[model samples]
Target chain A: MTQRSIQMDEKIISRVDLLNICQDVIEKGNTLLTPGVADYSVVKDVSNLNLDASALPSKISYKSYVFPRTEPVLYYKRSKNDVQLIDVNIDSKKIVILGAKPCDANSLNIMKHLFNWDYSDEFFNMRAKNFIVIGLMCSHFDEYCFCTSVGSSPVSEKGSDIFLIPLDENNYAMKIITDKGKEFITPYSGYLKSGDENRSKRITENVKQPDVAFDSSEVYKWLGENFESPKWEGVGNLCLSCAQCAFVCPVCHCFDITDEDYSYTEGRRMKNWDGCQFGNFTLHASGHNPRDIQSKRYRQRVNHKFRYYVNKFGEILCTGCGRCSRGCPVSVDIKEIVSNCKNDQKELR
Target chain B: MKELIKHARELLENGEVAAVIGYRQVSAKRTKPVIITDPEETSALVFNEYCLNNLAVYLTKARIKLLCKKNDKVLKLAITAKPCDVHSIVALIQENQIDRDTIHIISFNCHGVAKDFGFDFNGDNLASKCITCETHKPLYYDALFGEVKETPQASDTALARIKEIESMPHNERFEFFKSEFDKCIKCYACRAVCPLCYCQRCITDKTIPCWIETSSHQRGNFAWNVIRAFHLSGRCTGCGECDRACPADIPLSLINRKMSMEAKNLFSFVSGRSLETPTLVGSYNEKDNNELFM
Candidate 1:
C-alpha cells in the first residue's frame, strides 16, 4: 500500500462564509451533519451548528452515519421449494460532517482497517467512501479524556479531510489535507481567501491538550502480562454489563447479524451493533459461555482496545473521547482503569 | 464520614461482612461507587450529596454477589445507601431476589443528592427523585449515621411535565413517546442500573422466539420501552436511575411514574415500603378491581 503525503494548502474563511458554504451544501440536497448539544444531528438550519472548540465531544460519535446501528444486509423470500434473494440497495449519498472533534475525526480511519481486513464489507465501504470529515481543533479536556496517551491530540488532524483552526470568533483558518477535501472545496472557492500558515500553526501549537494519563505501550504490556490479575474482578464487580460504552464509542465496532421476518415468506438479514460487555455476546449453542463471568468479559474489553487490536491492526481501538466514562451509570472510568493497569494497589481514584 | 469508615473497617476486619459497597470521592463534586473488601481500603469510603448512585443496584449483580462467599461459607455484604435506596433493597427482599439475613445495610439521613456528578447541591440541581422524597431516614438499617439535615426544596417540574404529557390527546401522547423512544440506542444502561431488573435473561435478549426485535428502529424501540415500563409497573421503586442512565435523555421515568400512580390508585399499594405487606403484582385478591380488564 502506498502512503499518502501530507498536503499543506492553507486557506481562510469567515464564520459567515462557512455558514454560507454549509447552506450551499444543504441546498445541493446533500446530507449535512453537525454536532448538536449531545449528538450529531442533521443540520437543516445552519444557525444551529455548534462549533464550540471547548465543548466536550458529543455523547455519541458519527460512526452510525457510516456504519448504521442496524441495517439490512440482504432480503430473502422463501417459497415452497426454493428461495429468492434480494440484494440491499446501498445509499451512496455524500455525507458532510462539520465541526467534528479531532478525536472523532480519526475514528473512521481506524475502523477502516477492520472493515477491509479479511473481506471487504461493501456496506461499510460505500458509506465510508462518501464521508467528508471537517475536523475542528478542540480546546477541551476533562478527567476522562485520554486522547494524548493514544497517539492523538486536541489539534491532531490525523484523519480529517479538511481541518479547521478557529483563528478568532469570526474567522477560521482551514487546511486542506486530502484530495477529496480539495475537490469538495473547489466549487465553493469563492468563499476561500488565502491566509498565513504561520498564524494558524501558532494557534494550533497553543491549544492546550489533556495531559497523557498513561503510556499506551506500557498499558499494552501490562494487559498482555496481567491477563489473570484480580484487577479485572474489581472492575467487573462495578461494571453493570451494559453496552453504552461500546455504543457511544468513537471506534469500538463490533456487530452482530440476525435474520428478521417481515412476513411468512419474506425477511431481511440485519446487522446490528454488539458489545463485548454483554453476557450473551459470547454465549455458545452448547449452553456454555466461555466469558460467562463479567470479569473475563471486562478483561476482553480492555485487552481488545489496548492490546489485541494494537497487535493485530497496529492501531488502538479507542479515541479517548471520554463519552464512556462521562455517561457511565456506575462511574467506571476507563482512563483510570487503564492508567492503573500496572499498579499493585489497583485503588479507585 | 469518619464514623462511616470506622464502621465499615470494623465490619471487614471482624469478618462480619465480605465486602462493603460504598461511594468514594473522585473529584470535588463527584463520587463513584467503590467496593472494598480489605479493612485498609475502608478509609476511601465517603458519603456526600454527590453520591447519586443507588448502591443497592450492586446487591443484585451476580459478580458482586459472589463476593459474599469466602472459604465455602456465606458472609453478609454491607451496603452504604441513601434513605431512598433502601426502598430498592426492600423491594429485592420482598421479591425474594436476595436473602435478608445475608446482607447488612448502613444508611444515612440523606437530605438529598445533586442531579448529577458535577452539579452543586442546590435547589436547581436537586435530583428529581429527591424533590418528592418522603423518606429522609432509612426505614431499616443495621447501623445508621449522619445528622438529619433539611432537604432543599425544588419545584416538581418532573411531575408537572408528567401532567402535561397526560393532558395531551391520545395520538399526540403516543407521538410524543414514539419520538422519545426512537432516540434509544438499545444500550440497556437503564436496565443495568435498575436494582429490580435482575432477570438472568432479559425478554429483549431472548432470541429463541425473538419476543422483541433487537434493532433500535422505531417499532423495536417502542416494543422494548413499553414492555420495560409495563414489567416495572407495580414493582418499580421510582429511584429514577433509569432516567439518569439513559444516554439519550429520553425522560424514561415519566412512564414509570405514571405506572406507579396507576399502581397506587388502582391497588392502594406503594412498592418496597414494607416487608409485612405482600407485593402488589406478586399477590392477587378475588375482590381486586376488574375495570381495567373490562
Candidate 2:
C-alpha cells in the first residue's frame, strides 16, 4: 500500500458547523429532487431534534433518517378486464447521511445482493444509492456490540463515502474515501486542516476497543457441527418469537413478495421484511411447515448468518450492532449465543 | 432401521408419495433437508436433531413445482416434524396456506432435540428454545415416532424482565428501552421464522408515503419493533419462535409473552394445544377490547 503521508490540520469545526453543512446539502438535494433516501433531517423534525447529542458518551450516533416503520405503496381503484397500475410515487431523494456509524452503513451493501439479485427492486436501491453515508469514528464499544466479530470496527469504512476521524475537540481530520466523498467535501475543504502528529494521535487514541469477540467463519463451523447439540432448546426456550431481533438487524435480509390490487386489478407488487421466527416464514401454501419450532427457527437464523450465507456469499450476514438485544423486549443477545454455543460451562445433572 | 427406510421407500416406490421429504446426514457434521425418491435413496433418510429446518418453507416452492399444471395431480409428499414444527402446520392449515389432506405428515412426538453441534449430537446440548416448550408433543400427524417426554415448566425470565422494566418510571423505562432498540438494522430474521406471522404482504416495507423510516435510526428501529409487536398482538402464541430466529439476538419474546398473556386475560384464550378452536384474535366477539376505539 502506498503510504499516504499521515497529516492533520489545526482547524476544528463544531458539530453545529458539520450539521449546518449537512443541512445545506440536504436542502440542495431536496431542491434538486435527488432520487433516494436523504440523511438530512427534514420538516416536522421537532420530536427528535439534537438526536445525536442524546446518544452522548457513545462514540458514534444513530441517524434519524429511517426509511419508515411501514409505508403504504399507493391508493388505487380497480376496473373490469383492464388492469390500471396506480402511479406509485416515491419522493425520497439521494442524501448524505452524516454521523452514521460504520456498522450500520456497511450492512446496506451486504444486503444489496439478497434484495436485488434475482429481482430488480427500485424500492431499496433508489434510496440506497441516493444516500452518501459519512461515518464518524467511534471512541467506545458496548458489551452487546460485536461489529468486529462480523468484520467491522470503530475505524471500519467499507460503506462510507467520507470518514471523519476526531483529531481534537475543535477540529477533525477528514479522509475522503470515494470520488463521491471528494465531491461531498469540495465545498467544505476549507474546514479541514493539514495532517499533524497530535491530530493523528488524537484519532488513534479515540479509536475504541472492538465490541464483539468471535470468528464469524468459525461460527459457521460451530453451527454446522452443533446442529443436534442441546443448545437449540436452551436458547430457543428464551425466545418469545416476537421477531424484534430480525427487525433491528442490519444484515438479515429475507423478504416476502405479494401483489395487491384495489377493487379488481390495480395495484403494484409489494415486498416486505419476513422474520424466520414466524412459523409462516417457512410454511408452504400446501400446509407444510418446515420451521415450526423455536429451536429449529432459531437454528436457521444462526445457520443462515454463520453457515448458509457463508456457503452462498462467503460472508456472515450479521453486523453485530447489538440493536436486536437492546430493542428486543426479551433481550436475546446473539453475542452470548455465539459465546455459549461453544461455552466452556458444563451442564449439571 | 432398514424397516424405517422401507416405509419411506414404499411411499416413494408405490407412488403413494412422489417425494419423501426427510433429512439425511449431509456429513458427519450436519443433517440437511433432502427430497428423497426411489428406495435406493431411502438409505439416506434418517431422523436426527441435525435435521433442524422446519421444512415447511420448502413446501410452498415444492408444491408449486409438483402441482404446476392447473389441477394436475400433485405429488404425494411424506414429511416429518416435531411438536413445534406441527404448530406451523396447524397455523398454515388455519390460514389456508396449504391443504391438510394433500400431503402426508409423519410426525414425531419430539423428544427434545439437541443442537446437532458440528453434526455431532452427543456433546452439544439441545437448543435453548426446546427447553421451555410446553408443546412437547405434536398435535397432528399421519404417523409418529419417539416417546413423548414431559418438558419441565420453567419460569419465564422474559415475563419477569418485562415486569421489572414495567415497574420502572414509565418514561425512564421507555427511554432506556428505546435507546437499546435504537440499534436495529432492519433485518427481518424474526419475521422469517414466525409461523402465525404469515402475511403475503407486510406493512413495514411500504414506501409511497413512508409510514416508518427505513433508515436504521433509533426512533425508526423502536417504531418498527412496536409495530411488529402490535401486528402480532393476540395472534402470537407464547411459542417465542421469532425471538429464537433473531440473528441480532433481540429479546423478541417479551413482546409476544405480554400479548399472549393479555389475550388470555381479555379473551380467555391460549394459543396452540387446540386446532378445534380458533384463537381469540382470529375471530372477534361483540364485547371485545373496545378500549382502543373508545
Candidate 3:
C-alpha cells in the first residue's frame, strides 16, 4: 500500500484530456461521472463527460453517486401463510468522479460518519469504498461561499484520492495522496512527468483563499444555549420549508424507507432522500407533530449541523459549499444566518 | 413605493395588524418576502420589478397561528398583494381558510414583474404567466396603490409554447416530460410555495397505505408530479411560483396552464376570479361533462 507522487505536464494531457480518462474507465467496464451543464446535471460515461472546470462546484454535489436519490433496497412476496424476502444486490464497480471541488470531496468524510455511526449502511459503504474522488482546487468563490469558516480551504484534500491544482488554462498539477490514488493512476503512467519547482510555486500562490465569514466555535456555543431563540422565527419566516437546501447540500444524508407494490403478489422496498424540514419528519401516528411550525423545523436544521452533529460525531455536518444559498428561491444564506447566531444580541437589523 | 411602506408602517404602528407580509430588498436584483412586526422595519419593504413572490402564500391557518403565538388575541395580518396574488386571497377566503375580516389586503396595480430583474422584460423574457395575465388592477382591495396600467390582452405567444408541446407526437411529448421529470430531486418546492397547497397533510406524506411513492426515481417522480397537478387541476391560479421554485427547472407551469386551458374550454371557468362562486372541482352543474364517464 505504498503511495507515489508525480507531476504531469500540460502537453501530455490537457484539461479536456480528462475525457480520455473517462473513455479509459468506460472501456474497462467501469463508470465515469462528470459535472454537467454548469449546474445540477451529471453526465455519465466518457463520451458525455464535459471537462469544463469553470463550473467548479456544481449546483448539486457528488453525494448522489454514493447515495442515489432513490434506490431499491429489497423485494418481498406474500403467499397464503408465509412471506418470502429477496435481497437487492448492489454491484460494486470502480467509479471515477471528475471535476469535484475540494469542498465536495471533503463532504464524503462528513457523510461517512453518520451513515456508519450507530448502524452501517452497506449500500452507501460499498459505493463509497469503490468510488474514487478526483478533486480540483476551486479558483472561484461567490458571495454565498464560506468554506474557510467551516475548516475546509479551497484546496484541502481531506477525502480526495487524487488532487488537482489547476496551473494554467490547460494544465493541472496532479498529486496522488493515497495508495488507492497511486493504484488508480498506474494505468496512466505514460503521462507522468518530472516535477517542476517553479510551476509548483505558482500553483500555491495562484489560488485565492476564500475569506472566513464567521467563527463556527461561536455558532456552536450560541446554538447550545439558545434553543428557543426568537431569531428562529425571524430567520425562518421566509423559508418555504422546502428540501432544496438538504437535497443540494453535499453532506445531508437523511433518507426514508417505503415499499411499492407491483401487485398484491410482489413489491419492492426503496430508500429515498428525506429532509427534516418536512412536516412529516416527526409526525406521530396519534395525530401529533412535535415540530409543528416552520420556525421549529428550521431551528432543528441549524442545530443539527452546528451543535448536534458536533456533539455526537465530533465533526461538522456542513462543508460550506454554499449551494443552499445560491439555489434558494428566497435567498436564505446559511453564512448570514450562522454569523447572526454568533453575534446574537448585536442584531444585524 | 413610499406610500405602500407608509401604509404598512401605519398598520403595524397603530396595532392594526400583528405583522405585515411584504417584500424587502435583499440584493439589487432580488426582493424576498419579509414579515415586519415593528414599524421601523416597514421601511425595508419595497415593491418593484424584483418583487415576484406571491405574498399570499403566507395567508394560511398554520402560518397565521405561528405569527400569533406571542399574543392571546386573534392576530391580524396585512399582506401586500399584486393582482395575481389577490386572486389567491379570494380563493382562500372562499374556501373559509381565513375570515375576511381578520386580515387586511393591501392590493396594488401591476403590469408584470420580471422573472429575473438581471434580465430585461422583453416579450421573449417575461414570465410565462405574465404573458397571458389579464389582471392589471386587482378586483378587490381594502386599500390600493399605483396607477392602473393597461391590461395586456391574452397573447397567443403564451399558448404557443403549450401548443408546441401538444403538437408534438404523443411519444415525443412523453419522452420530453420523462427527461424533465428525471431531473426532479423531489424537493417539493412546488408544493411549499403555492398558497393553495394548504393541505394539513399532503397525500405524498401518507405512509400507512403509502399513496404516492416518495422517491425521485423515474416511476416515482412521474407519479408524484402527475398526482399533484391533477389535484390542483381546476384550482391553480397560474401564479407560476411552482415553476419558479423548482431547482430542477421542470416546466411545471406547462402542466398547470394546460389544465387551466381545459377548465376554460370545458366549463368556461377561471380560478380566483371571484369569491361568490365555488371552485370548478368543488361544485357540480347539470351541463357538466358526463360523456367521458359513459
Candidate 4:
C-alpha cells in the first residue's frame, strides 16, 4: 500500500462538524449511512446527514444492505431459436455506515463464515468488502439487550473500521481500527485533531457489560440430547411460528431462490429471504414435512443459532442485539428460552 | 379474577378438561397464553386489561390433538374468553373448525382490553376492537365469571378511517397501500395470530406454479395482504388481532373493517352473531343480494 501524506491517527470531531463531515463524505461519491425513519414509525435511515439520536437497533438490521431481502441473480429471454441469459451487475460503490452499535458491527463477523464456507457468495462478499462500519459505543441498554451473553460488549470494536466513543455531548473520540479506517480518515484530517488519550480510557472504565450471562455450552449439550424432548412441545405451544425473529436478527442469513416470470418469454431468477420458523421451510416434494409441528420448527430456530452454528463454525450465530425479542409480537425472549433449556422440567410460562 | 381461577382449578382437578387455556403473567406488565394441565398451576392465570391475546385461536384440531396424545381419553379443553374471543369461538364452530362439545367456554364480562398490555385504558388506550365493541357479555358460554358490564355504544372512528381512505384518489390510495405493504417482511405474523386464518396450507406457501409470491417487495406484499384480507372478508370477527400482531404496524384493520361494513350493508350478514346462522361463504340463497355479482 502507498503511504499517504496525511497521518493515520486518533481524531476529535465535534457534533456540529460531524454533519459537515457526513455531507463531505457524500459529496466525494461515497454513500453515507445514517439512521432515518422507515415505515410503521421505525427510526432507521435518514435522508442524507441527519442521524437519528434514538440509537436503538434498526427494526430491519443493516444485514439487508449486504444480503438483500430480494435481488435478481440473472434474467433470461426465450426466442424461437435461442435463449439468452443475462447476469446482473453487483453494486461496487463504497458505503460508510455511521452510528452502528457494537452489537450491529459484530454481526458481520458472525455472518462472514457462512458466505465463505463451501462457496463464495459474490453478492455478500463484494458488499462486505466495499463497506466501512463506524461503530458507536453504546451508552444505554433496554430489557432485551444481552450483548455480554454472546461474547460481545457495548464497546467492542471487533468488526468496525472506526470506533467512536462519546467524550461529551458535542465531541467524539475516534479510534482507527483497520487499514480501511486509516485510509477513510486521511481525507478528513482537516476536521480532526489529536484526540485526548484519557477520554477513551474513561469510556472503557464507565461502560458496563450487559448483566445477562449463561453457560452456552451446557445449553448446546442439552439441545443435542433433547431432540425429541416433550419439553419442546409445551415450550412452543404459544409460538405463532412467525419469522419476526429471523427477519430482525442481525446474523440470520437463510435465503430461497425462485424464478419469477412477467410473461412466457421473459423471467428473472431471484434470491429472497427465508426463515426456518416458517411452516413450509422444510416441506419436501414427496408431500411430506419432517419438521411438521411448530415445536420442531421453533427448535430448529434456536438450535441453528446457539448449537448447530457453534458446532459447525466454532462460533455462535447471534450477537445478542436483542432485536428478535423486541420485535416478536408474542415477546418470546430467546434469553429466557435458552436459559430454561438447562432445567428440563422448568415450565415456560 | 379469583372466580375464573377457582373454576379453572376445579375443572382441571376433576379431569373435566385436559388443559385450561388462559393468560398467565409473563412480566409485571405483560400476560401471555398459558396452558395449565396441573390444577395447582391455575394461580398463574390472571385476567385484566393486560390479557389482550385471543386465546380462542388455540381451539384448533391440531393443537387440541396435542393435548389428547398425553392421555388415551378424549381431550377436552376449557378456555378463558373475553367477549370478542367468544365471538371467535362461535365463528370457529360455525365453520366446523372446532367441535363445540369438546371445549368449555369460561366467558368473562369485560369492559375492554387495552391497546397495549403495558398501558392502562383511559378511553384512548382501548384496542380498536374495544372501541367499537358492544359485546360486553359473551354471546355464548358454558360457565360465566365476573359481573356483567354495561355494553358500550359502537364508535364511528374505524368506519370514518376507512371512508377517508376510500375518498382518496385512486393513485394516492394505491401509493398509500404500496408504502404500507412495502414495510412487510413477509413474516406472516398477521395470519399466524388470527383466529379465523386457520388454513392448514396458506395460499402463499404453494410453490407449484406459485399463486402468490412469497417475496416482501411491493408487488408480492400487495398480493399476499390483499388475498388474506379477502379470504377473511365476511368471516373475520373484527378482533383486530391481525393489526396488533403485525410487526410492520400496518393498518390491516382498515381493510378488514371495510370488508365487514360492506358485508353488513350489502349482504345483511353479521358474522359470529349467532351459532345458528351460517357464514357468508357457507350458505347461499336466491334472495341474497346479487347486484355486485352482476
Candidate 5:
C-alpha cells in the first residue's frame, strides 16, 4: 500500500474545470464525472461553502443517482411465438461523489453486501463499481449532527476511495485508499505535493461536534435481557411511523422490489426504499402484522441498529451521522435512545 | 396476558373453544402467534407489550380454515389486540372480512409494544421504538389483563431535527434532503410497510399509464416518493415502521409528516382511528377545494 499525499492547488483546475477533465476522461473511454445538475448543486452563493460539490438540494433523493428510486429491474414482452425478455441497461457510469461525508461513503459497503449477497443485483453494483468516491472531512457540527458517537469521526476513512483533508491555504492532504482512486489520481500527478504527515494527522482532531458517548459493549447484553422492558413502549408511542429516521440513516438498509407494467406485455420490475416504521413491515401477506402496534415498530428500528446489525456484521448499523436525529420529525435522538438502552435501568425494571 | 392463556388452555382441552388462538414466546422476550388445539402446549403462553402482532388477520384465516380446511368442530378462538390493531379489526369487520361473534378477544392493557428495529445485540443499546410509546390501554376486549390505562401522544418527526433543519435557510434544508434523497437506493421499504398502502394495484407501477417514471434520475425519484406520500395524506398512521425497514435509508417520514401536518390543518382528520371512516381522499365533500388537487 503506497500512500501518496498530494497538494491540490484550489484554483488551478476549478470544480468546473474538473467537469471538463471528467468529460475528457470519458472521451478517452474512461467513464468519470463531476456529477451535478443545474438545479441540484448549483449554489447561488459560496461564501462559507468549502466542499467541491454540494449534494442534491431537494427532497428528490440521491439514491436515484446511484440506486435510482425506480427502474425496470427486468422487462417482459409478448411475441408472436413466445414471450421475449427485454433487459434494462444495468451498466452504470463512473462518477466521483467528490465531497461525500464519511458516513455516507462508508455506507456503500453495507449497500454492496445487501445487493450482492442473496442475488447479485446488477443495478446497484453497476453504479457502485463505477463510482470513485472522494470524502471530505467535516470541520464544524450542525445542531442535529452526532457522527462521532457511532464510531465515525468527520475524517473517518471507513468508506472512501479517496479522502481529502483541507490544510493551510490552497492545499489538500489527499489519501488514496483504493485502486479505483489510484487510477483516477495518476493523471493528476501534477497536482501532487510532498507528504505533510503532521497536518494530515491533525485533520482528524480539527472537527467540531458535541460529544455524546455510550458504552458500545453494553448495548447488546442490555437488549438481550430486557425484551420485556417498559421503556420501549414509552418512547415508541411518540413515533409517527413516518420512516424518516431510516431514510436519512447512512447504514439502514431495507428495500422491496415490484413490477411496473407499460402495456399488456411490457413491464419492468423496480426496486425502492422500504422502512420498518410503517405499520405492516412485519405483516404477513396472510394479513397478520407482527409489529402491528406503533411501539413494536419503533422498537425494531433501535434494536436493528444496535443489536441485530452488530450480531451479524460485527459493526453497528449506525455511523452516528446524526442524519436520522436531524431528519426525524419528532426529535428522537439516537444518543438519548442508546443511553436508555444501557444497563443503568436495572433498578427501574 | 398470562392468566388468559391458562384459561385458553383449559378451554382448548375441554373443547370449550375448538382452538385457542394466541401467541407463544419465541425467545426469552420475543413472541410468535400460534393456534393450539392441544392442552399441553398451553405452558408456552406469555404476555407483555412485546406481544405486539395483530391477531385480527388470524381470526379470518382461522374461520376460512374452519370452512374449507381441516377442522370438523365449530371453531371459537382467543386473541389479543392493541388499539390500532383493534381499529384494523373493526375495519375488517365493517368490510365483512370477518365475523365478530365467532371469536373471543382478550385485549391487554397495552403498555405500548416496542417496535421491531432490525438490529442484533451490540452489547447494550436497543432500538428507540421500545422507549417512546404513547398509549398504554387496549380499548377493545372480550377479556382484559394487567391494567387498562390511557395512551399518550405520538408523532414520528423528530421535533428538534425538524426545528434545526427548519431554522436553516430554505435552500440549506432543501440541500440536506436532496442529499438524503440522492442517497436513496429506491428499496421500497416505505411502501411495503404502509398499512394504508393496500391497493390491489398501485398507480406508480403501471407503465402503460406511467403514473411515475422509472428512472433513478433526481426529479423522477423525488416525484415517485412524494406522490406516494401524498396519496397517504390523512391516511398515514405515523407508525415509523417504514423508516426502520428501509435498506437504503431514505428518510421517508419527512414526506409523511408534511402530509400529516397538511392533512391535520386542512382536513381535520386523523388516520387509523376507526377504519369505518374513509380516509381524506377516499370520500368527497362539497366544502372541499379542488385547488390543491390540481
Candidate 6:
C-alpha cells in the first residue's frame, strides 16, 4: 500500500453553489447525508441543509452510515439433508457526508485499523471505501467537549477528504485534502473560484477549542498501574450500565453476531452493535462472567478506550465528542472520570 | 442545603449508614449523582431544582448495595431523594426488591425540577412529571429536609398528547408509534434508568431462546419497545428519565403514562402510593375484570 500526499489545493464556493453541487450529487443517485438539528439524515431537499458552524455536534455521529447498527452478513436455508448459504449484497452506493464535525470525521479512520487488523471485513470496507467526508470547521463547544485532549481539535483536518471553513454568511473556503476529494470536486470546478488561504487560516485560528482535560498517555499509564483501584468502584457504583455512551460514541466499535429465523427453513445472520457496558457482554456458556460486576465492566470500558485499544491499534478509541455525558441518565461524565484518573486517591475519596 | 449536608455528615460520621447517595453540583444549572462514603464528602451534597436524577435507581444496583456491607456487618444505605423519587423507592419496596429496614431515606419538600440540566425552573422549563405532582413532601422518610415551596405552573401537554393519540384510529396510532420506534437505536438507556427494571438478566439479553431480537431494525425495535412498555406497565412511577435519556427523543413515558391510566381506570390502583397495597402486576385478585381476555 502507498500513502497519498496531502493536497494544498484551495477553492471558494458561495452557499448557493454548494447547495447546487449537493443537488447534483443527489441527482447522480449518490446518497447525500448532512447534519440536522438532532442527527444526520439523508438530504432530499438541499435547501433544508443548514450548516451552522457553531452548532453542537449532532446527537449521534454518522458512523452508522458506514457501520450500520444492524446488518446481515449472510442468509442460510435448511433442507432435509444439506444446508445452503446465501451471500449478502453490500450496498456500494457512494455516500457524500457534508458539514461533518472534525471530531466525527476522524472516527472511521480510527476504527479502520481494527476492522483490518485480525481479518479484513468486506462489509465495513465496502461502505467506508465509498464515503467522501466533507468536514466543516467547528467553532462551538460545551462543558462536555474535550476533543483537544484526545489529539483532535475543532478545526483539525485529520480525516476529512475536503475541509470547509466558513468565511462569512454566504461564502465558504474549501481545502481539498486528498486525491478522492479532488476527483469528487473536479466536475464542480465551474462553481469553485480561487480562494484566499490567509482569510480561512485566520478564521480557523480564531475558532475556540475546549481546554485539554487530561493527557491521554498519562491516563493510559494510570490505567495500567491501577487495575484494581477503588476509583473504579466509585464510578462503577454511579454508572447505570446503560451503554448510552458507547452507542453515541463516534468510535466505540464492538458488535455481536446472531442468527435470526424468518421462517422454519430460512434465516439471516445479523451483525449488530454491542457494548461492553452490558453485564452479559462478557458472559460465558458455563454461566461464569469475568466482568460480572458493573465496576469491572466499567473498568473495561475506560481501559479499552484509553489503554487497550491504543495498545492494540495505536489509536485511542474516543474522539471526545461528549455525547455519552450529555445523554447519560445518571450523568456519568467520561471526561470527568478520565481526567481524575491521574489524581491522587485522596481527592477521589 | 446546610441541613441536608449536616444530617448526611452526622449519619456517616456516627457510623449509622455505610454510604450516602446524593447529588453534587456540576455546574451553575446542573447536578450529577454522587455516592459518598466519607463524612467529609457530605458537604458536596445538594438539593435544588437542578437535581433531576431519581437517585432511587442506584439503590437497586448490586455494586451500590455492596457499599452497605463493611467488616462482615450489614449497615443501612442512606439516600437523598425528591418527593417524586420517593415513589420509586416505595414501588421497589412493594415489589420486594429492597427491604425497607435496610435503607435510610433523606427526602426533601421538592418544588419541581427543570426539564433538563441547563434549564431554569420556570413555567416553560418545568418537567412534565412535576406539573401534576401531588406529593410535595415524601410519604416515607427517615429524615426530612427543605421548607415547602410552591412549584411553577406548566401545561399538561403530555396527557393531552396521549388523549390525542388515543382519539386516532388504530392504523394511524400504529403508524405514529411505528415511526417513533423506528428511530430507536436500542441503547436500552430507558431500561437502565428505570428503578423498576432491576432484573439481573433482562429478557432481551437471554439469547438461548432470543425472545426479542436485539437488532435496531424496524421489526426488532418494535418488539423491544412494545415488550419494554408491557413489562413496565402499571409499575412506572412517571419519572420522565426515559424520555430525557432517549437520544432519538422518543416520547417513551407517554406509553407508560397511558398504561398507568389504564391500570387506574380498570383496577382503581396507583403504584407506589401505599405500602400495604400489593403491586398490581405481582398480585392476583379473584374479582379482577377479565373483559379483555373474553
Best by TM-score: 1
Runs with alpha carbons beyond 4 Å of true place in candidate 6: A1-5, A347-349
Model 1 agreement with the true structure over A245-307: per-residue lDDT tens digits:
999998989999999999999999999999899999999989899999988998999899999
Q: What TM-scores does chain A show, candidate by candidate in order?
A: 0.97, 0.80, 0.91, 0.91, 0.81, 0.97
Q: Can you tell me the DockQ of model 3?
A: 0.61
Q: Over the stretch B2-67, how does candidate 2's per-residue lDDT look in tens digits?
A: 555777888877777766767666445455555665568799877756556565544444222353
Candidate 2 residue runs with Cα over 4 Å from true position = A1-12, A29-78, A343-349, B1-294
Q: Per-residue CA lDDT of candidate 5, range B1-294, in tens?
A: 558767777667766566665666644445555556568877876665455445454455422236323356556666656555665555555445556666667666664554442223222222233334444454456776777644333453354565677688989988887777665544354654454555534665554556676454476577777788777667665555566445455667656765776777777765556545665666788997555774
Which ten contiguous residues of candidate 1 chain B have the minimum total lDDT?
Answer: B60-69
Q: Which 10-residue span in candidate 3 chain B carries the lowest summed lDDT?
A: B149-158
Question: How is the predicted docking of candidate 4 categorized under the CAPRI scheme?
Answer: medium
* lDDT tens readout by residue for model 3, B1-294: 899989998988888888988888877777777888889989998886677888888788476556755557776789998889998888888878877887799988887877653456455556777876778889888889988665334455647878999999999999999998988899998998899998878998777787788878898899999998898888889998898878777889889989988888888888899988888888999978765475
Model 2 lDDT tens row, A1-349: 1112223233345555665665676566542111112122343222232223113122112222323334345545566655454556765675565565667767666776665667765666666666676666665565567788888876776777766666555556566666666666778866555555476556656666664577776677777788877657645544545566665566665655555443344545544456788656787767688876667888888888888877876667877767665444334567867766564533100
Pairs with steric clashes in candidate 3: none
Worst 10 residues of 1 chain A by lDDT: A1-10
Q: Which 10-residue span in candidate 6 chain A carries the lowest summed lDDT?
A: A1-10
Clashes of each: 0, 117, 0, 4, 120, 0
Predicted model with the maximum lDDT? 1
Tell me the deviation in Å of residue A283 in model 5.
Answer: 2.1
Instruction: Evaluate every candidate with DockQ and list the scores.
Output: 0.83, 0.05, 0.61, 0.55, 0.06, 0.83
The interface root mean square deviation of candidate 4 comes to: 1.9
lDDT of 5 by residue, A107-208 (tens): 777666566767887777777777777776666455445567677777786677777776654556777777777787778766565666676777667566
Q: How accurately is candidate 4 docked according to DockQ?
A: 0.55
DockQ of 5: 0.06
Query: In order of the candidates, what TM-score does chain B achieve?
Result: 0.99, 0.79, 0.94, 0.95, 0.67, 0.99
Q: Which model is ahead, 3 or 4, in terms of lDDT?
A: 4
Evaluated against the true structure, the overall lDDT of model 1 is 0.90
> Which tens-of-lDDT digit does each residue in B61-114 have in candidate 1?
877788888999999999999988999999999999998898899999889999
